[model samples]
Target: MTAYRDSGAPPAADTAGTRRPTVVVITDLIVLAKHLRLLDAAERRGVTPLFVFGPETPADELARHRRDPRHPLSRLADEGLRHVADTSLETLLRAVAPWLRERPVRAVLNVGEVFVEAAGVLAQTLGLPGPGAHAARVCRNKPLQRLAAPALAPRWTLLDPARTTAAGIRDAFSAFPAVLKPASRMSSSGVRAVAGPDDIPPLLPDYGLEELLLLEERIAGREFSVETLVRDGAVLWAGITAKDTNESGTSFFTETGHTSPAPDLTPAQEKLLLDANTEFLRAVRFGTGMSHAEFRLTAEDRVVLMEAAARPPGDAITRLWRLATGMDLDAALLDLALGTEPPTAPPRRRARQVYLDHPRGHLTDVTAEDVPVHWVAEQGRWPDLPPLAENAPARGHAVLVSRHRGDLLGELADSQGRSVSVVLDAPLGTGIDAAAHDATGRVTIHTAAPSPAATTEEPVG
Candidate 1:
């Protein structure tokens, strides 16, 4: 999210040209991907990002990076974030010694979910505004969320993964069909909802119950992820995104395309949301920086706050901000962290980000009937995929982009018809192989588990 804030604005023009302050994005792949646009803006303004990563991140999992000659930015992984527990503070700081000394990194951006503790430490030493230990302890801890949420976002309560017991589940089973989630988990990775206490034990091992937990009171509402760039008492550039998640709705990352300019909220509600965001940050003393927050609006007109992250939105929500508003959020984030006035006007563009999803089928052999299809695993550009994987699912998506909002879906659906589906020799589900439909087909297929108990969600807008 901080990445897109840069837009086309030249790098900090007010700073020293020879050795401009650097923005250190402490991250893995997604963090780096989020910064691509900022890199472009930085290139125009004359700034280089010193991105660092850890080795624990798989190369395959890290979105593909190409050494294209034409590209202005160069990303080099330093495998530091992954080893937070082992690396000493001085040793870690010394790793980026060159950039720290040369560029004198003025602002430190914390995008890594697992590195909040490390980030807070870094920010304190560097004199930056981020989720320091006190802040992180308050935000990430399940116990804290339970205590604070009722007043801040009255509809919600914390769900402690550690203390959530069978008795606790039984007592609340009638009124609240509790959703069990890890207190520290960023996404829906370990979030699950069981109707009764009986379902609790089976989930302990996978949910990592070894740690403290958050047994949040399940709020019946429409889910929405809010992204805000807070500077001083104002939310400089704020945007709301529709989040599509996995079956558990717990995927830390979104898996489907997000439409910008979220529908359904009345002008009053929108203002309340924006105002509540600023006020909440004010309570936290969130003076400056990007913050990602998720909420659910109930059937009763109650607005809820789920989790408030003290940084920019992740996934491609960064792109959504750029598309919805003309504001360059990355630059705004840099400015905010550097104590400079971040701009409120979003950049002008109809931007959209779509995650390619396949039905519940194992990957089979996939091949494009046309020449080949390019996949955007990240914000940057990629030439084309080599070929569909051996088990790539038959029903998949091809994210498309266009300025015509009304015709965007039509265009995508049309372009989808251009590609011919290849036949697969595998079975369905895990065995589902690669196969393409005829020239006439939709560009993408969204998958949801087939459950008799599953309920459909009404469009919030």
Candidate 2:
């Protein structure tokens, strides 16, 4: 059962004497659950947000959301939620036509991965602030990103799965120990390392015939991502985040953890990374909103671009920044979407998020019941931890579990495989090593052996 019905009529809008300017938010259900705080900020700022869900919510899941009052669809019932048949620019423009007529749209914000292009096109068409169509196109397609900023990108070759044979792929690219990735997927969905020529054919069938793939030179270095807030083609604020991934001894490159204001960089390394990120953002012509650009610092002190995304990063990165610095990134992101100046504050703390992965089995329990936690999406029985003091030397932590009992767990092959996450807040001048260790010790994920007939599969949500 899906949560939405395909009604031709427009969603209910403000019937009050004065209508607030609407910020057309485009996203899917999964991402929507993670962005309730942004909605809260929007309301506080006196902005009306019209949500356009680009994907369907399964009936059972919708029922689950209805059961939890914290879900966005339920909590923001007054603000309209529209289910669009497709995410093309035309479809989105038509779906929001009625609301566009009723209230002025201040911005068209892309909140989910798939809606970036549509949101960009809509925002540009309406002359609003957003990652314009060019930035959206380059950000969405990895090949385009490589083309747009060749200097920042690693050496790579593009292959059309429909036309290129395994031999041709082998001939065109010989950077053994390379990474084969789909040009437009997110969360390392179709990203894997290839040892040599023999690895090409075996993986070809895994991708779509029409999909374009990249054979990129495997960059050996410390991986990091730069999160930047841009306006009018200039960077306002940028922070470096150190990344931990399972790719060290494995073929899959699933990110396991992230720490904000990367604590390991020297003065020179920090300048190089921030400079490279600025160059990449400029190359893509990113107009406004947040840009999460990833890079690798090679052993020889070179920065290589992994990829970039034109949306708030997944895995609570924005939240980590907010907790680490006094800045409210969610509120700032809303302000960017509304074409206003966001409040700024200096960093007074450090924060890290560590994803908990359990052995392959049926998830039986996640032990954090006694510890006070503030759930990011749905609430549990634990008492909520109060917000950390802004000006004091304070430490805080929160636990979030995305899986329930009896769900099957799998290898940490990608971002989706990790179920539980721990976030730690530390006072300024604290190192990431200590905070990360504390966070990892805060939660334990226990799993039980699956039935004899059970097959290896993705975890049930």
Candidate 3:
């Protein structure tokens, strides 16, 4: 492993007109493809985006991205894509030294979950704004977040599946209607709600024995997530996102939909949720960066944190925020990273994204009956959305369908199981909930039941 050779000299300052300002972006190809808005924002700011890919990134995938003219990576500055031998802190720092050796970096930002800690370290080492190293580490692990901010977390306990069985844990702790979650997994994978002691045994065998899990008392209440942007230990902007999930009558807690600037929240309730989130950020010692923190507002008015991530909110929540508040979160994130003042605006409208469900079978076709729709059979392809209106609502819905013909439709076990999503924006005081429902209702998913012969006929000699 090579160590970074720091020259003990300050980073070169950008003289107003003489030097060009550049920001380093750390991400893999998959995330890069999904977030084209980042490139748009960088262009708007006249800031160059320098790219860095981890050593594990497949060369073929990188080449494919470069070949695509529309991909963000294709438009990088000359010699912009810096290569790192490995993601180790030492190697990463050494790899980017040549770029920062002359021009001072405005920011070192990470777009997805995979490289939070690395970006944090990079920002700190270069004297730029970022979530501190400690905060980044804490955000990646669920149990760590619980321990970091005990006051905000629900009653939770940890267990090592390799060392014990479901019955063993059930005997030790009998908290009914509790949630079982993997310590470090994302997207609701391996996350289940145990109704009672008996439910534990059935669910425990599905997880790898080597996994560490958390059992927590499920707080009964409305689900919501707080999207926060912070710099210098202070909140620059915060927005609440209302969440809908499949946990109502199901064992799995997959998120079904989300709405930004969560409508119908009273002043006191909004204050409570935002205040709790701020306290959690303070407790974690979050220095800078965007945080997507989820919470449950119980009937008794307690804001219990579900978890938090040190990155932009996923599942199109950022897009909804942009539509609702007329704020380009991607642009704002860049501004925050560069130490420039990020603009802010109160929510003038409500924007929502809802995922549609279908029966389990072989997929035949999915179509929109009347309303215009965007179908995505291929991965990493985004719809060309209309521009955000300055005053009125965007006045339309953007729908995305993920599956293609011949794809298998499975049970709704997690967030990944759902394939269709709808996004709509409306003027303030309008009940977007119904609009979302109506938009989804207009789409039809046609499926053919699986053939028994396919399942029964196995390879035989």
Candidate 4:
């Protein structure tokens, strides 16, 4: 990764003096692909875009994009990329103010969780329509969500990891099973459940949670995320996604896959979820843009809001939405930021996405064969899969589509059950979950024995 220093000098003025509207994008390195989509969308709408990237951006990834002909970054304008050496709020504002003054900024946008606050601050500073810094802070901090919307949120308590000992947490959470997570983080990073005091300390070092944390009573039931587009403080479009995760022995909540248009939810159930989300968003004062809110449905059919972010959903959820509903959420988000109406067409198809995970070891070979259903995309090496933990990365992805809901669900179950049948020859014992989707429509993992050809050889770097 190349390090960037703060260039105190101001950006060169647009010599052509054309007053082309521009969108200021504040984001981090990990979400470059999403950034590329934003850039392409802006250009398609005849708007200029200036990307202010955090210093942590990977130089190698940028170089790869510049080399790939099909990548949008390959055609990025000369002044498209700028670096902010310091990501602090004050420093970011200082660096971005001058740039916005030079161009006619339509809106400030961000997809990554880390930069949402910056985008909100920029919009508020310039008096543009946005979620605002207060809303962004409420969305980013998990405990704040509970405090802001207590009636809709799960029971939670804030903890100072630097001061609170494990014994204190145990006493406070003795009545019920609880979840411990960082106050502000994404991708399930530093998120785990705690049965008692004994399980707390061991997991702290792994997450580096020596700061602020949120310990909430774990809501038991089906998990789902409601994706919404807000305009004038009202929800214009709402899409529900059913989530599947490794439910065997893993303490972490890493998603194994997701299906869109959640076939299992009845119209009434879906309405309840959406209504709760809308109320929560209102309580948080989310005035504009897109939101991805997670919730749990108890056996009594009650909805409990977990958390919500002031941005579009990641992990190809937008792609699934596009495939199912003919709604290009990426484009919609850009349009929303630019103060335009987005598409609100009903869904036409069902879509699903499954991620590949294996044991913790280097891989020698991998293959996908006899896949009964056609896949949208799949590519990755077995040796490169991240370990099963918080923020575990997906090794490969397979997207499936169907015209009917029942057929799509059946296809998803079959594909998930047989997904592990793919040959993954690795030295360590592979954790293959043969029955990933159960009859209840929940995503669970059932580990099976390793194949006979498996060897104990060391992995290659």
Candidate 5:
């Protein structure tokens, strides 16, 4: 269930003067949901934010779409964009390229980096948007991000993957518990938190993979992400957020939403972050769209830049901006991409997003009455939270969304607490194995949610 146009055609121009505010890259809920939040913000302000894309997917996908935590395509806006289904990205560029060439889409905001980089090329090719492919590479690569940080936020060290060693990694950060991460992968793809001499292996991938990783002195204090809009080397309308990261794996974001307007900082600290972000943006040279800038509110109260992506936060944190702060981060991002006025700066109150998760083992069952439920795909992705392709030991877990973080976490904890872990009676063996058509406990035990007090049952031999 994607927010797409079924025409099976690429995005092309429809009317002249019709502004292309911003084109979202990944239409998954996490990113696209921000667009919806912006649209919601705009409608309140009486301005119709416009961008071009495919039309709505089928109704069946609606449930699947809603079930996904990332985003639920606004059926209301579906009619706005022509539905072009079963299309490829290359086709999309081809269709969009020709039309935008004549009109010049004005500004292209890329929510997805791959698409953003691709879109950046298109904009550069059309001479309408941000930097070209050359700049896109520098903005995306980690080693580059590290090198560029000094110009923006903190001062850090870089390690070449090929020649770097464990001893070097330790020496690089002066033997401090350093942060190690892949220069290219997304989410918790290869990010790790290494404490001391012993915690290095997990952080360092030895066998095969890119060697380029940053040995950063893991900063202490609150971790927040700053969402920035860069226009030709300038950072404008920087919105900061206290990010919610997983307890153990620091890379993977378990849940996000936002606290409206973000906690205000001391005037001086705020200015410093603003200054750093501006410098970083200049170094990256992103002329349009959004970027996720990670920073640490250090014990010294200084903002330390962790990482910056040429895109928005992957999870639907923007949605929280809407509910908590009343800011249309998506729309603002769109305008930023199109070089327009701020859209996400609208007024918003308290906001937070949380997920219901199973702390351990297999999920015997999950049920949501009418609301919505979804699985956290490999590494806990929102929309496409598909289980490990096949019978891969259900390593990851599922996520359920709620309006507030407190409620979601509470429900998740409670639900997980009640969930039967192994349900030992049903191993993938004996007559019970693959008993797809059975109904009784032997070969036919069906799916059901047990009362919280239900007793553990044993199978008769």
Candidate 6:
């Protein structure tokens, strides 16, 4: 094993020549589970994993992990983890240049949204293979993505919130039922649908003056996310995921469930989605790493692009893919970042993730039952449920797997009303509709009923 020093000094001479190729990971926060997977993958491939913490990272947190003998970070050589005062490209270059000179860096990667741009810039600056900073910038800016592939997206315009007036916006998009949202936000934050000029002003205060907003005609169709691995700008593998959202709520868009290997999609729809994704990747100049591209299939069979990111999809989609298919998406992404070929495999099973949401009020307890399929995992908070909006935080989540597609969906439907619910009259599965015509179709949970308890309760098996 190669031992690194924290004093900014190069590792001692590799007398035995046993040091493995090193890959640098830039992250804003330390997710222990994710890092453990990365470390194990690197070890299996005979590579060294070096973690670089950003300036904003809590030093005490890292110190605590470092001091614990059983923690993964403690297993690394003394110099395995390093912290810098600034995350700027120049600062990073100055900080890591000496270390790189000592040990050749195989790749530079980032999984956090905030550090995506930095990862690209550093990889390019260091003469490593990556999508480059331009692609990263396009991935972060949704409006720019639409512009890059206008033919694949709905009619849209980017507006400066400070200068754009409600009247001007209405005039520009006189069409009712247009969608307005921040140009560069995640988790559907600040997204809204407006019927006219009167509906625009009230939503403006929710956004910041400096934030760029995108106003566009909403496309009606089934929304799906295409997860692909690109090598040298060509897609090696593509998986489509069918999405379910809270459509009945007028306030915000909240995801309800997602089924992978979207069994319902026709062959033509799948082809269109994959083809459009390839074009979108090319337009964005994404060269390598995993790309998560979202799109909608209209009733008229039109394929409209929503946005693409040069990273793995969140919400445990990677785990879902691994269950449905024999592919380890996280490992594949790591391989791509390290300039190695990723393995490809076909789907062998079906997997679905359902997010349980309760009505707004004190959450007394959460429980799951009558799940007819193989249960994979469940996680969330309970008992102390905070006030929740239509897009409230998930009360809990469950992952189920099966060999048959029908069994998965059947189990989902069967577990609906009985599996998860709040004390209010609104049941978990009530009014939850999946539509082939619109991506925003959702199950609306009415929270008009009062809460019976003030304390939270652990999830019942």
The best candidate by TM-score is 2
Q: List TM-score per model, in order.
A: 0.68, 0.90, 0.86, 0.77, 0.61, 0.76
User: What is the C-alpha RMSD, rounded to one decimal, of candidate 2?
Assistant: 3.8
Tens digits of per-residue lDDT, candidate 2, 276-350, equal 999999898999989999999998999999999988888778778877776777678888878887977656677
Instruction: Give, for candidate 4, the lowest lDDT window spanning 10 residues.
Output: 376-385
lDDT of 6: 0.63
> For candidate 1, lDDT tens digit of each residue in 1-461?
11111123223333455655566766655455445555655555454555555443344444334354444333433321222212235544655555565456766766656555566578767777664555555555555654554555542334455666677766654545566666676555566665666777767766554665555556766667667776654666677665544434431323343434455568877776666666556655555567777776777666677777776775556655653454666667666656677667532322334433333322212233342333333324422112233344333323322111111111111112111121111111232111322211334332223453442221110
Residue 181 displacement (Å), model 1: 0.3
User: In terms of lDDT, which candidate is stronger, 2 or 6?
Assistant: 2
Clashing residue pairs in candidate 2 are: 1-59
Q: How displaced is residue 83 in candidate 6, in Å? A: 4.3
Clashes of each: 41, 1, 0, 0, 31, 3
Count clashing pairs, candidate 2: 1
The residue pairs that clash in candidate 3, if any, are none
Error of 5 at 9 (Å): 6.9
Candidate 3 per-residue lDDT, tens place, 126-223, comes to: 78988888898899899999998888888878877666666777777766679999988888999998876667666767888888888999899999
lDDT of 4 by residue, 44-118 (tens): 898877777776555565556556675566765546566666566776676566556677888887777777887
The alpha-carbon RMSD values of the candidates against the true structure, listed in the order shown, are 12.2, 3.8, 5.9, 10.2, 13.4, 10.2
Task: At residue 105, give the lDDT of candidate 6.
Answer: 82
Which candidate would rank higher by TM-score, 2 or 3? Answer: 2
For candidate 5, give the lDDT of residue 173.
Answer: 61
